[model samples]
Target: MKKIPETMKALVAYGPGEYKLVTDFPTPDCGPDDIIIKTEGCGICAGDLKCQLGAARFWGDDIQPAYVEPPFIPGHEFLGTVVDKGENVTEYEIGDRLTADQIVPCGECEYCRTGRYWLCEPHNVFGFKNFLNGGMAEYVRYPKTAVLHRVPKGMPLLDALLVEPYGCSKHAVDRAEITNEDFVVISGAGSLGLGMIAYARMKNPAKLVALDILPERLEKAAEFGADVVMNPKGTDVAQKVLEMTGGYGCDVYIEATGHPSSVLQGLKMIRKQGRFIEFSVFAGETSADWSIIGDGKELELRGSQLSPYCFPFVIEHIMNGDLKTAGVVSKTFPLDEWEAAFDCATGKYGDFKIAITF
Candidate 1:
């Protein structure tokens, strides 16, 4: 249809650290199986800058609770088009080009009858609320179980908002099971640790590495494959990965730095039973030495939430050119500046992945 608008530009989140940029906001209602996209590009994550720096797992309590719920409309990575549908939206229509799947499932949990709907259980994390209502905003509403994807059409628009962080880097590199005799690592280079270094270098691992304090994101984590790129500040990144693996350490770490000292530097660079895979989101709480994960090394941690079925496997590796995601969305902003796009998306104003356009 294309003739919808009734109030658009949004940004809400009025609490913890606060935010605001509305310009009439109200514009989302499609329900018969809903659809209504039109967002375009949204990104600004790091869990929306740790729920705007109030993180207690997004502002909760002494035992976790707040999975964000401010004035709503935060942003869940993002991408758009679909302009208006309902009338039983048969798997998307008007103009297509979508991107949903920010959890939302509860389709009668048991993790939605076993497909493990991102571990459903009353979860509903679009921009973190009771249900979908995000994408910084210019209309959003998905509904009918909301698990969209489509997105192909000439990509680029921050590569279709990088299909929501490469579908959370394909579930944190499939829970860090990378092979080729593994050695991995990946701590964090931003933008979901650069899509977990382009899907942990498509499983050819045998070394990979890439820690980051940001030398242009460790030079884009060595052009997204990283054969080694540390900067764990003042070195000793777990004794330089135990002298680059010679003394054994790392065999799949993948934290994605939401920082808590990269979870004690991935519990001192993995290795015993290896396979760490946490995929960060901290803002607090990050101890260490539970005897270095039990008896100075018995690891195998693994946590990675969201992007469950890997949204059509990261939109089929970003529509087949394999996850490079072109120039990692260096920057973009417009929806009324959005506080200078959240001050260049929290990096004060530099270092890629920003998006806000409309």
Candidate 2:
């Protein structure tokens, strides 16, 4: 057995734009119902970047309360190996590989009682709360309330790192309720968007379109599943999509870019009775004409939160080589070089998903 240590290296976020690396941060303790694991890797998400930049959704404003707590270790897309289990923890052994859902739901909440734990009212997510410290460090503690899943012992690092994002992607695609006759357009070809394309392809939609401002990401989108790739920079995306659908527009439009423009673009390019799934963590509030929903398109707009119950399916597909995860994790950095990893994730060097290896 690997001996547990008292102190470990970690990257902690104090506030917006104030993340620091500390070598002597205390290792997390294992409660009677908790288990501790040695982290294998943690992926940097666009939401993490938004949190660092003090986006209104995370930092909050007069209209909304902040969702993030400072001085917390920030990473939810992670995988690890069990190193220690408390006396009351018997479901896992020391050598087991596992991961937990991002959110630690309160089982008594209305949403949790109704089998919708992802929408639990206090919504304490790992990496955002002090008590539920995340896997950006060398070791992490998983509480009993966590929804744990055993990862296959032989799963590749890239496939393992993709579990969280793909779970989220699966949930978002499921919200769209795509059919073989529908023309689906997904905006943003980032990690989440690429995963959405891959999962949506399994439904075999008539046309799968991907939109991004970056040429490199658009190329990667094609490899994943997009039948048509378009750049929104110079193209009239809504017009082109409308023309392709005989003036009706795409049957479903999923906004994953987090940019306000993408939301407006979806409103314009969706058929009158289409479903639009908004899954991005936007930097700020987006302004859209209400008429587009009520009088204009009569659209169905749905918001997708964290991955609900899709982890098992994602792990199974990835392990079976059904979900194409290759080239998605474009880079990996050591925990000490977290700043550089964040830079790559924010597109300084142009990346898909960036991981911090332990």
Candidate 3:
């Protein structure tokens, strides 16, 4: 008689302000439309912190009893290797290095048909409610609809984990229409903010000003190609941006901070016809006064959600050395110490992105 396999280690959220390492879980089995992957590395995002803090109502705050329930893994930004493939799947085979976009949109929805797939009603997330199992474990399963892109040869696994966030920033930069002659302002020097600074630098923006509250993060942003870094604590952010641009408001503004006031302040930093792109992913409601956007200033306001057209570009940059991430990755932790890693990222202990390696 054959014996049944049992047990694997995973980082699970026990409740608000608590995450415990669990080991009595079954390793995932492949389904007809699924492929199993061995996690290489995964990034800790600020949004993940919000989810852990009971702000995860998007998936229902209550812990339900089911195969998919709380005490579930909580990592969405991941990169891994395909270890097993289920029947009828031909796009990928065993041994492929891939990473997935967090949400797997339902392809039949009108929003998907119209290219706004991020709004798909019945969305699935690997690290959150829908999938319930994420890459924080030894393995993860990818459904047919997930946007799994192949990692190029020689690409660092740590940097691969950054693909999702980099894709998002690239999308925002595209929407802002940054140009060689345009002066651009990036609000927030977080991981996503630094990525925008890197992507915008590639387009040769006349000036790339990065605004943030932390001095360490600002210094890191400057190292990542920001023309100037400003700490809003001592200087008026809007005034500094205008002065740097010779009295003309910046030509483009990219807001990566979900803070309402940042978005409102962004409005005052852009030129009459400039573009403003909002790229922050917050779990709760974010509101800003509309009067700044009401007078037909001919300004353009765009919202860049999960990236739909940036994975390939991100890969290209990594391959060509244009998007060096050596400095972007500051620390790494093993699977067992995930709680400590999450705490560091949530507490803003460093100037770079935090990652977990298995």
Q: Best-fitting candidate, measured by lDDT? A: 2
**What tens-digit string does per-residue lDDT give for candidate 3 at 1-358?**
1222456778877666677787876778778888888889888887777777666443453553222356678888888888887797899978889888777888888888898777777666778752547878888878878878999747877778779889888888888888899988899888888888888889998888999888888888888899888887888989878777777798888888777778877887888888888888665666766756757457788888777768999988977878756667678899888878877886467646888998
TM-score of each: 0.36, 0.98, 0.89
Judged by whole-model lDDT over C-alpha atoms, candidate 2 comes out at 0.91
Off by over 4 Å in 2: none
- Residue 305 in candidate 3, Cα distance off native in Å: 1.0
Query: Residues 1-358, candidate 1, lDDT per residue (tens digit)?
Result: 4578788878788777777788887798777877888888788877787787678877798897776766788888787888778786675678878888777686887878988887888887888672566888887887888777787788677777878777877788888778888888888787778787888788787788888776888888788788888788868788889887887888888787766888786777677888788877777776766777768788878898877778787777777878887678778888788777777777645466888878
In candidate 2, position 88 carries an lDDT of 95
Predict model 3's lDDT versus the native. Answer: 0.79
Best prediction by TM-score: 2
lDDT of 2 by residue, 1-358 (tens): 7689999999998988988998999999988999999999999988889988887788788999888887899999888999889899988998999998999888888999999999989899889877888889999999988999999989988889999999999999999999999999999999999999999999999999999999999999999989999999989999999999999999999999989999998999999989999998878778999899989989898999899889999999998877889899999999988988998999756699999998
**Counting only residues 3 or more apart in sequence or on different chains, how many pairs clash (N, Cα, C under 3 Å) in candidate 1?**
0
Error of 3 at 121 (Å): 3.4
